[model samples]
Target: MIRKGSQILMEVLQEEGVETIFGYPGGVVIDIYDQLAKTDIRHILVRHEQGAVHAADGYARASGKVGVCLVTSGPGATNTVTGIASAYMDSIPLVVITGQVPTHLIGNDAFQEVDIVGITRPCTKHNYLVSSTAELARTVKEAFYLARSGRPGPVLVDIPKDVSNSEAEYRQLKDVKLKSYNPTYQPNIKQLRKVVELIRSAERPVVFAGGGVILSQASQELTEFARKTQIPVTTSLMGLGAFPGSDPLWLGMLGMHGTYRANMSIGACDLLVSIGVRFDDRVTGKTDVFAAQAKIVHIDIDPTSIRKNIPVAIPVVGDCKISLSQLNRLIDEIDLTDVPRKRQDWLGQIERWKGTNPLAYKQCDLIKPQFVVEKLYELTRGEAIITTEVGQNQMWAAQYYHFDRPGHFITSGGLGCMGFGLPAAIGAQVACPDKLVVDIAGDASIQMNIQEMATAVENCLPVKIVILNNNYLGMVRQWQELFYDKRYACTYMNHSPNFVKLAEAYGAVGLKATKPQEVESVLAEGLSLPQPVIMEFEVDKEENVYPMVPAGAPITEMLLA
Candidate 1:
């Protein structure tokens, strides 16, 4: 039977178990939208193309599935760039479909025409421009496969307007065998042995897990390995939920705003077993000096990420879950009953670091952002699926929230995209309706995509927005305060609409808390509402996130406030 390209795409999406899609229609995508309406898949029409991609990103992060988005050509396709790039950096799996101008107009610079496939080539794991209907199903299959396989990332498929209406004999290809796309899932036995030997022998050992663990759904294995080995674990920003934040052995997030203990532990460790992490510049302050005293064993599915940032003594190339499983099996073989656990001293030192200068902020008449997050965590009992806008709000959320489950904490780590939380919360809430989803946002960052409130309101998603209203761009202001001698340029945002009225105008609830005492009550009321809400907390204007490791400085060399 012949099928239209749009119909074939829908069939493939159904086969892929896609339950929902976030998209915005345009001139080139009218047929696709028509087909979309005929399918069982729920279509979320976002206010902007960027929100659609971001919503898909959040859904992917929250559900551990390949989130999908669709948009039209030219401006619609271009708007998705940042969202796609954000997903790429964090290694989130996404299949982004963009509408393109009909084939004959390809290089003619037609209306609503731009080379999106070429535009997103660098950011996407892979991309294709399908001018013919024959390749539609196969290309989509390939796009989804490439997106969720190995080191997960975004993939784009540009479908010309003409192709959507064209006829094709659709075929269901389950075994998508791409000759050049083989990913290593198993690690070398010798290298795995070396990693185990180091772990067994080292007295001072630390586990640094990254987003790879979460992407592979290996958090249970990660937790088991850490506990069995009696090693403390610290996660990158993207790896927040990879291990239980409430676990006694779990150190807070490790990076520029990492806990003092985590940074110091990494600095002093003899065996740094880095798992599923790319040693990005933010995590490894100075390349030469990062983990200088440690014998680093880097395990990852992508070989490029292994030595891309820092040199490692052992590089085990394979999937994180598979490699860790192998290491765990071998660890079970070793008779460690004779060798006593020698990590007590190291644990004690980390505890000392934790005791000396912990993540703390003073409570005053003005609302404190840290206090707000802490209260939110307390009220939610660490069960809420929390997302964040970039800046001080992101850092504070990371520091305070205790994520005990994988897929419960979603945030933009690598791209540090502002206006991420609100739309992301929409996606997360849509994915897990029964769960509480909140976006911990700063006053400045929240405004970046404040328009998303309409999406939430229209959908009646009930996603909570906890805005840390400090009347300034908190993070950039912090940098200027410390590094540029308080040359606060355009960071201050003094004049703003009353968020409560703004929420009401959008057909949602809005509440504000000016004092520390009113924060909890305001939060509880907002969170309990049956509709979307924007709760603005008037936090201290000059308060800055501390235990900050300035750029280029050693992670351990932190400036504590």
Candidate 2:
């Protein structure tokens, strides 16, 4: 008796130590789903295929594991596009499996079929369209390897329906080889020496760390490097948890809506050593003006990412962890002693600015944004893994929530996608069942994937959802308030379903806290429940996340609303 391709896929997954998969089943992928059911691998059925992918992304970000998402072809596969792009922009590792039409109907446009491999090629780190049962094992192995290796991003495997049911030898693919896909992780010592030379000579050297630090598991290395070099550090949104938020040298996220002092630090630096961060448009407003005075040393795992946006003085293409280790080894301990702490005045200025206009909110009768964030921080105490929906809530969480360790915060930083939180929370909870996981979302963004509460309830995953019930697309409304004269068009969500009631209907705990006085109690009650809970807070409708980085403004020119 020969094994089915679907069985082979599961066997490969087991070999890879995959514990869970997030997915939505469809007709074409039923064989694979059936195989999944027989295996010990826990499968989470998401409300939308898109949510499944995003949840997988969250799992990868939180656990540092290769996330797996499965969906059927055509619309089912296509639905995951946004989530795939989000993972791509943030460089998260994901392995996506999509069911295809029968192998025979390759280009005939068969029913319930789309060119998924082609559609996902640009967004995915790599893609495979398994046309024959013979190629199934190899494809699956290659997909996993590609997803988990170097500067990881989403990888796609499109398996045809007939191929899934086809008979083939059950030999596990052990000797998988990809000549073109090998990831070089060693740092160039010569280039690194030049970097050290630059570091020693520069008066003001700032390290602009990005998600790459976490992805490369180089957070400790980064902290050590900063401490040794006596350089102030600033981070991108995705890089928030890579360094201790409370560290004296660490300036918070740098971007539009980034901390004022952090942005100023980025602007004032003479030599900017950016690691594992792609200089996105949001972070580097006008390329010409961003870090204009800084000589950039761009270090990253992906070579293509070097100098794509910002000019680099030294481009070191290697794994950040490996590179930092090499840098640590090469630099003599005594030489670092002479590396002067040249930025005391600079540090003092930044601290003074941070002290004067710290992230603050009024203690009015209404529930404030900071209070909601602070309460969550207090309850969870930097232990719970957090996924944030885009917009003001995301910024607020980034600003107020002190991330004590790396990989504790997951958000759609690169794409800044709105409907990311709930699904991501599901993924985080699945990745680390012991940890408290929270999805902090806006009421407008929460409704986007609120249906995933069913997934949480079904899996018995206790994810606390704190909906900042602002009743509007808070981020866009802020844009309108500042730029468009407050002429809100489609930001209001008066037609949204009652979120607390919606949570109840999904067979999970439901809660509401309309005032600051009720915040602590409702949060306590929500946290006490071992099942999924949705706590809705009626925040000030017109509230805004301060320290706004106006569109296209230089990092130093932030606006406080």
Candidate 3:
């Protein structure tokens, strides 16, 4: 049927089953906005362009769906880079739509025009610039297809102003096929058998899982495989919630700021079965010494990620869930009874590591951030969907709050971007209205996108914010204190604004907890309210995240506080 490009775009979005879109309007995107207003596809008008992308990213992470965002040319599109890069690093699926100048203005230094597709080329998995109305529908289809497919990442579609205003024949594409872009979903049978053999033979084996396990919905298979084999499990930060945190086999997160037992288990295990992990520097610490004693078996959807960081004895390239499923089936054929006896002593040693002060903070008059997180987790009964801003607060939330299911804990793990928590909480609240959504934020990181408080208030999202107010950029300060002779350069935020007053000004509920005793009451009251609330907790300023593997140090080497 014949339609305007804007109408066709909306039709395509509806066809893709996009119930909501986060975006802002500008000159180039006015046509799409006009059409958007007339349709039922919910559009969240964010205060900033960056928040639009971050919100979409959050929705994707929380709901396991492809997040969608829209913005205009120049600065609007440029502002999405950080969020885009964050999604790219974390492998979150997102489809970011931006409007551009008319086709003739390409590369002419036109006002409000920038080559966003070119700029985001390095960050996005793929991008497209729709030059003609005829190509608009297909480009939109390709964008969503590429965004949600294997090894998911953000994809951008730049529609020019004239193209959206022009006429086009629209057709809903039931399927999108990229001839050159096929991802292997099934692991090679030989490789799968080798992995099973290694698991059966090793005396001490450990499973290291990452975001891919969650991305592929392989948590159940992961749990089953671990339980059946009687092997302890550890997770990278992004891999939290992929395995039940309360599970007896759980070793907590592994790497810098991870549990003592998890790091030590990975260090000492004879066989390391790594799934969906990228082996990033934060997780691997010193790569040469990482899993030195283990015969590593790396399984991932992306082939490039397999041997890129650390050498592996067996590399299985396939979907995490599918690969795990294959291994489980193959494992069924083996004499699995001996596996438990073989790894029993290994689990005992891990228990000893767990006994080594897993995580603790001295009780004092001031509120410790870990204590606050624990109380929050307790008050929520581990049910609240938790998002976090970057740095110490992020680490503390990961450590103290336990997640038993996938999609419960959301954070910018790979990019470690500040200002992610607030918008992410809003997105999660929007996606799951009945769930209590909280952003555990650092004082400095919270301020970065504090403007989104208005968006939450306007939408009546009832998203809660728990700011660990130490009056400093806590994480950077800790590094300075530890590594740089306490230089304390630009890390302090002692002059920060009153968060309670700021929350009130935004027409949202605000509360404060200055003493340790007030932490429980503050969390309960803040969570009790039905509206968007910001609860600021004054925490110990000098407290640092412990069990730290100093950058470039072996993962086994730690500085415990």
lDDT of 2 by residue, 366-397 (tens): 99987989988988887889889998899889
Please, what are the lDDT tens digits per residue for candidate 1 over residues 484-524? 99999999887888888999999999999999999899989
In candidate 2, how many clashes are counted?
1
Candidate ranking under TM-score, highest first, comes to: 3, 1, 2
Model 1 TM-score is: 0.99
Candidate number achieving the greatest lDDT relative to the actual structure: 3
- Against the hidden true structure, what lDDT does model 1 obtain? 0.92
Local distance difference test, per candidate?
0.92, 0.87, 0.93
Alpha-carbon RMSD, each predicted model: 1.0, 1.6, 0.8
Q: For model 3, where is the 10-residue window of minimal lDDT?
A: 336-345
Segments of candidate 2 deviating more than 4 angstroms = 338-341
| Residue 321, model 1, lDDT | 95
* lDDT score of residue 281 within candidate 3: 96
Q: How far out, in Å, is residue 268 in model 3?
A: 0.8
- Candidate 1 regions exceeding 4 Å error are 338-340
